[model samples]
Target: MSANAEDKLVIMNEEELKRKQREKLKKLQATGGNPRPARTLFLFNLKNPFRKACTSIVEWKTFKIIILLTIFANCIALAVFLPMPEEDSNNTNINLESLEYIFLIIFTLECFLKIVAYGLVFHEGAYLRNCWNILDFVIVFMGLFTFALDTINKIAGVPPPAPAVAARVTSQPDPAVRRKRRPIPLIPSVREADSEV
Candidate 1:
């Protein structure tokens, strides 16, 4: 084809692609999806310096990796804490509760950053619009709620509740009593063997 014809063909293709995208977006919106436009709508003024900074920070790959690693570390800490004996947990130099609080603070900060970068729930591409984001939002609030309760308890001089495992263990029969119970024999007893003979 001639150069002019090629140029016209390319232009037509570009227009066709744009049309397809528009149609797809319309279908998505019709089905209750929040299809965001090329130009995003921010909760606050787009020109605000803090919001702009937050948007950049939230979009950075390193920031996402750091959050993922923090989650992994928190999971490892929980795993270590769960199987530990209640007695050993108290004597350990590393306080798992304090580690949990630190993890919660990091997650809460990440949540706030995303909220500033993307609008909370009103705008398209808002923080709470995605299902995963909604889960994170609920978890952060739950952490804050627990933190508040812990603080109140400390101020009121109320003791923390015992763990269910600790309570169950405490209620079990004494070790000596448990040891006295005879095991059921899989083989015939000597008296049974003599009678058989």
Candidate 2:
């Protein structure tokens, strides 16, 4: 083809590339994602051991399984801790406060592990930016708040100190009667009153 046609062809290719870029930007905006995703380093970096281990196939599988188990455990704990209806009439079998605590610990650890793997910025819809991550964070925060409230309630519910016992009052014998019965001696018996006998 002639040089002019070749130049036209090259311009058309450039236009096509620009069009694709524009579409990409639009798509990113629509999805609430950054068109130009930010890059971060440190623990989340590819070379970091945390990121490496987390992303590894075997490790990821184990991590996922553990997370799933924790969720299941949480369900069981929830069922156990839920108050029974009046109709059920004291049929509750288990007290799951301890289980719930275990679930919270496991859930918290899972979230922390994910954050450690994905980095804290959560830019590009990763880490804290992801919906799942946000939900986990909120849940953990609420759990902490609930724990605080529980502690406060426990402290407040404690019985107040018992009131002091009342002291009994007795009538004293008449001083005149005692003096008459003792009879005053001219010399003080054994005990001297100062120097004057």
Candidate 3:
């Protein structure tokens, strides 16, 4: 063969070899051949039953975490507003109010997004039947109650009462207001009635 033809043939063979190598690498990758050892705990396969159970419990979705965080925020707000001597100060009250307001806004937005993503039927409890759905409804309702209470208190020239305090004060029934029983009147006998007449 001519030197020029030989050089061209060598170049073509080299290109073909490179192409084959690339294809072989791709096939190995596709099959996960020669995988690197798992470096982290997450990559390791679960062998212990307890560890597997724990992993299953902790492997929650992003939406589930958001719901849990929303619930936790509201619970913290509730704890802040509880009728304790430590929380009765004006500064603490204001702080708690602001925290509650922020949590409510976040929860409201979260509910809106859930409704938009899942549609009205799903948001209204068409699918899931669990504690998360119940908590979502409660948080939304509590947010609305807080807004309404704030408006009413603003209009009435009074400070807004915390829900914990309001619930405690209203839930107690007065012990002094028990109804008295009326005495049954005895019927007079006929002879006694005649003598009286």
Sorted on lDDT, best first, the list reads 1, 2, 3
lDDT of each: 0.80, 0.64, 0.60
What candidate 2 gets wrong by more than 4 Å, as runs, is: 1-59, 80-94, 152-197
lDDT of 2 by residue, 1-197 (tens): 69999999999999999999999888777645633233333434545565556446324777789888888877776666545433232334444655567778877777666665555664454567777778889999899888888788788996433233111112344678778888866866465665556
lDDT of 1 by residue, 85-168 (tens): 453456333688788889999999999988877878776678888999999889999999999999999999998876865787
Collision count for each candidate, in order = 0, 0, 0
CA RMSD for every model?
Answer: 9.8, 18.3, 19.4
| Two-way lDDT contest, 1 vs 2, winner | 1
Which run of 10 residues does model 1 get worst, by summed lDDT? Answer: 34-43
Ranking by TM-score: 1, 2, 3
Model 1 steric clash pairs: none
Candidate 3 per-residue C-alpha lDDT over 1-197 given as tens digits, one digit per residue, 9 for 90 to 100: 69999999999999999999998787657536522211113333324454344334334476569768877877777777745542366777778877877777777766554433333343223213346745776768887997898798899999655676667767765454432344456899999999999
Candidate 1 accuracy as TM-score:
0.62
List where candidate 3 sits over 4 angstroms from the true fold: 1-67, 80-88, 122-131, 156-197
- Give the C-alpha miss distance for residue 44 in model 1, angstroms: 2.2
